[model samples]
Target: MSNPNTPKEDDKVNALIEKCTPILKKMTFSSFMGYCGGLTAQKVGRGMAIVIGLAFFGLQGLAYNGLISVDWKKVQDSAVSAIDTNNDGTIDADDLKTYWSKLKTIMSNNLPDASGFSLGFFYGLTH
Candidate 1:
């Protein structure tokens, strides 16, 4: 006895599945290498190395030619200020402690480790 609502598997479904076939294509390493080599040869020019080097390393020349401005005096002043924290006439352990204390206070207030927020806020305000 079979239920009226249940469907049964048939031979026609099996015959249709048996008549179907899949086709596959094979690839070779030599063909892939040949294509890569052709692309490299076509895209890479003789002056590419020189152009890339100049683009990255030529900024020194631009700076020398006055295309850029660098404040040497400001850099020296900052270096001196970093060493002289109390603005006193000496660089001692007290200055070092003052510098570290300021750093600790800034770090704790910002809670930088808990959130990924940086001192970029202060940087933007100053700059």
Candidate 2:
């Protein structure tokens, strides 16, 4: 039997819900987007970090075992080429502008709430 003086779990939950209900009701669309986008970014970021970490370790293990060979020079050259827009042999402001434009295009094409998400994404990354 439960203690008569103890608070029930359902009562605690109900109280918590009551406390949050007004704040939730007061949320606006932009604020809602910001909250959801930030939450999504945090979750996705953690997931991506884990996946990338596993891939990096897996690739290293394969290379160490002679099952795969990574051409470091090719990889470096491709990475440079990707960011060195205008082929100036240097990554500068113009390359960054190009990268931003490409990112914007991708965001618009893929996301229905790109602007709000972008704002929240930056906020999320910083916080």
Candidate 3:
């Protein structure tokens, strides 16, 4: 009684559920209720964290879409401004390279998460 031309619709639904069940399991009702339960500081903190995370992700998307542009040349100019130990008006490659070498000498240097960009965009918001 097997016809290879088509499969049962129930089988297709079962396959879809099997693929999504693991992800759905993680988002349980109790976990959501816990966050919405009390009006205490704990709930406030959780809500704030969620808001901040969402805002960060949204801004990241905007930046990626070119709705916002981070001014990287400003950061670079600031870093290299003091590198001209020769008192040159222009920033030559030699002076810039020297700055890079000195920067790497620092132990435990907390560099920016991205090149010419602030970590998590706090500076982008403030400045």
Candidate 4:
């Protein structure tokens, strides 16, 4: 047997549906995909930040406890050697300029969503 209150409940449901119909119609597939992509990027960025932060802190703790020793001079020498592309035994302004140019070219060619990913990465790091 149908309840006596069914008509009133049906009226309320119909009114709610009518109110939501416009909002549903405005949501397109592209909008949905864009939102999903952005959300995925943000989540991935956050995860990367967490892993990097943890690794940094872990290394710091280990270094502080003297569990591992780092030869800073050796490290600096290695870095200088790596950056000294001209092999002139020195990292001069010209070397830095060349390095910067190469880095810019590589980044521009490789990273398509660089701006968005960097923004999301910084946001994740800060927040």
TM-score for each model? 0.25, 0.48, 0.25, 0.42
Cα lDDT of model 3 overall? 0.53
By the TM-score metric, which is better: model 2 or model 4? 2
Error of 1 at 63 (Å): 2.4
Model 2 lDDT at residue 57: 90
Positional deviation of residue 40's Cα in model 1 after best superposition, in angstroms: 43
- Cα lDDT of candidate 1 equals 0.51
Selected candidate, larger lDDT, 1 vs 4: 4
Model 4: how far residue 36 lies from native, Å: 0.6
In candidate 1, what are the lDDT values of residues 1-127, reduced to their tens digit? Answer: 8885554466675556555523112223333333443345335643687786685466657778999866657755776777897787567799978864664455446342312222332222233
* Count of clashing pairs, candidate 4: 0
lDDT of each: 0.51, 0.72, 0.53, 0.65
Q: Write the per-residue lDDT of candidate 2 for residues 22-122, one digit (tens) a residue.
A: 97676545545655656776788799999988987998899999999988678768878887989987788999788767755664564556675556545
**Runs of candidate 2 exceeding 4 Å displacement:** 1-27, 79-121
Query: What is the overall TM-score of model 1 with all chains considered together?
Result: 0.25
Model 4: per-residue Cα lDDT at residue 85: 85
Worst 10 residues of 3 by lDDT: 113-122
Give a tens-digit lDDT track for model 3, residues 5-121.
665667987689789998667644433332233224345657889998897788678889999975557755775666665567567887757754553334114533222221112
Q: Considering lDDT, where higher is better, how would the candidates rank from best to worst?
A: 2, 4, 3, 1
Off by over 4 Å in 1: 1-62, 89-92, 102-127
